[model samples]
Target: MSYELSHLRELEAESIHIFREVASEFERPALMFSGGKDSIVMLRLAEKAFYPCKIPFPVLHVDTGHNFPEVIEFRDRRLAEVGARLIVGSVQERIDSGQLKEEPGANPSRNQLQTPVLLESIEEYEFDALFGGARRDEEKARAKERVYSFRDDFGQWDPKNQRPELWSLYNGRIRKGEHIRVFPISNWTELDIWQYIEAEKVEIPQIYYSHQREVVERDGMLIATGPFNTLGENEKAFTETVRYRTIGCMTVTGAVESDADTIDKVIAEVAGTRITERGATRADDRVSEAAMEDRKKEGYF
Candidate 1:
């Protein structure tokens, strides 16, 4: 029987092609490793792009100082396993230097503060192109972004002025002090990610699976009650089986009540879900209708 590329295989091939293109075109390209499922998938694609040799570029993480403990641990472990260099830009240092101001609210999140730190890191490292694992299906703003998203000298993105990409041709053109954000899996959906994770047996952080955690309900979302979100007198904490559909800063990233502890179950869950990952899980996105778009215009990953 004649066989064609399965959906997973097609996605894999497209991602690998994008990785190779990024490697060849940009002089100083770096992979943005957030220790999330998407970034982990990007790392795997990079690994496959240049097998029998080390991934030629360093991985960068704009540490928000409010990450899940499990994700940070997994970041280090994955780096060691792949023997890839990791460069972390500290949000703590930015806050300490007064370059970045901490959010003063009951729900303080460093999610917005990450933009400047990421831009500074790019300038410091002189990285011309940055590989991000942002998929279009995650948000409407991301859906508007091109595969090779060009940024200005100040790291601002003009979504309306993006260069047209046709027939898999990527335009990596950018001026000095300007850069591009390259997304390999921009075409993949959330279910596709979970399916790939299961098929490849990828090791993700424990938080992605079902676990008991103390959470409080606020703003129509379940916020994990931790150091990031101090329990208020009005808000009572309760333990529940929950897992993160999309992971971000601990303060802003909400977990959905779920019992999908295994990858197989997660795939099943994702398949049946009608809401987008960020819509269900990210409190930051709920700030405004154009929150993500505004952040993207300001150089957010």
Candidate 2:
């Protein structure tokens, strides 16, 4: 057979092209980095994309203040290694200032509260573009987004009003108050990301691998232990071997029991999994049918 680029190679090249285009075009841009696998992989691609020249943008983190320790540590270390500046958008600040009302319960997810903080941060920085490491195959709403998605001055996205972009040409045109949300690896699936992590030898958080953690079963998903959330009345927490499929605030995110200690194994696990990543772990998304879509309209990442 004739020579052809592997899917991983093709994805890497595509991300690199998009990164270069963003760097060349946008004046004030920021990356939404949550220290999750997707964001980690995106950072790695950026390093390769702008090799010789350091990354031209800073990473913005909308911290729910309920993140796993491993994830936060990994985030700090990775940013240090790449020498990229980090800007944190804290949900606690919003709560303390009475901007967002905290949910009253033993278990509460700050996922919904992050929208206002993220939008405020974007406005504070006057960012003309924001690069988010969101994948299409992860969720249904994401599938509807264009490569270069546009948001209005109010930070709302109208799916029906999306510009018609043909060929390789992405329309980044926007008004003064509006901005573009770029997803370089929009077409990549969960399996593809893990495969790339394996092939590229990128370092991810230790929680991705199987480990012992205090967990409780809630609505068919394993909710992992962390600060800022408590156990349910009938539901009791216990230690078990588990790993996070997707990483975010501990309140909203869940884990899966897998023996995937290495990247190769993780890729295999993802390839065989039946449920979508978000469907399995994201409690925020489980809130409503149009949750993610609604959040995107309200300036959530």
Candidate 3:
């Protein structure tokens, strides 16, 4: 009898293969768990990759100290369920130590500052490889990256100097001080992610579903009203039914107006939407045409 795998299964197989490869090839590796949809999917894939055995590597989170409280709560709960070790690199700690400075603005974001903290974590832990949930379709900069992206000794990325991944064979070679950022889900799209979550019954933060919350209209996006977000003079906070397309620092991540409360509804909504989540919701990406690219070059995950 002949059998075939569905598209979701194929994606899952590929991601699992990547996970196993990292486990076998790298001596010191960690999964970057941001508690976002993509990272949550990554965690699920990791679990399947090493079923009957707990995940071999620890999970790393670069805390910007500006993240949503709900996501943080979810991160801890999910980590406990999976029995994975958690390693956090705090941006706030770095700022307090005079190693990093907070950006000065009415709407200050710790997004850019996360790069240095991440690099410090890598150095402190001596991680030879780091697994990130970055997808190529998310942004143009990310699209240019290889599945096994290489980072220099200084933890910076040079897109033009990337190694070729000819065929399915990946080169995980790096110098002693160099490292790699492995993206297992580089080929998966936003719609594919929601579909996988729906099919697998993956548990994610409730903030992804539509709920009533106080939000302010800022620069053509709905910004949630919270301690990290300060409304402008003309901006007014009012209740709206909304959900997040992507999760990031609360100061920069925007919410979309939607009633997609369930997983099936989210998948349907994602299928019909033309705008990429980051393009529509992330204010930091709107700072410049090459905002993400610049950050990647400077070692931003």
lDDT of each: 0.91, 0.86, 0.93
Estimate, for each residue in 27-61, the C-alpha lDDT of model 1 and write its tens digit: 99999999999999889989999998899999999
Give the C-alpha miss distance for residue 131 in model 2, angstroms.
Answer: 0.4
Which residue runs does candidate 3 get wrong by more than 4 Å?
none
For all predicted structures, in order, the TM-scores are: 0.97, 0.96, 0.98
Q: What is the C-alpha local distance difference test score of candidate 3? A: 0.93
User: Model 1 reaches what TM-score against the true structure?
Assistant: 0.97
Range of the 10 consecutive residues with the lowest summed lDDT in candidate 2: 224-233
Ranking by lDDT: 3, 1, 2
How far off is residue 103 in model 2, in Å?
A: 2.1
**Candidate 2 lDDT over residue span 1-301, tens digit each:** 9789989998888889888888888888898999999999999988888998889999999999888888899999999999999999999888888888988777777887887888889889999899999999877888989889898988888888888867667777777889999999898988889888888789999999988889888878888755665777788888888888999788778889888777777878888889888888888788889888888877777
lDDT of 3 by residue, 78-102 (tens): 9999999999999999899998988
Query: How far in Å is the alpha carbon of 238 misplaced in model 1?
Result: 1.3
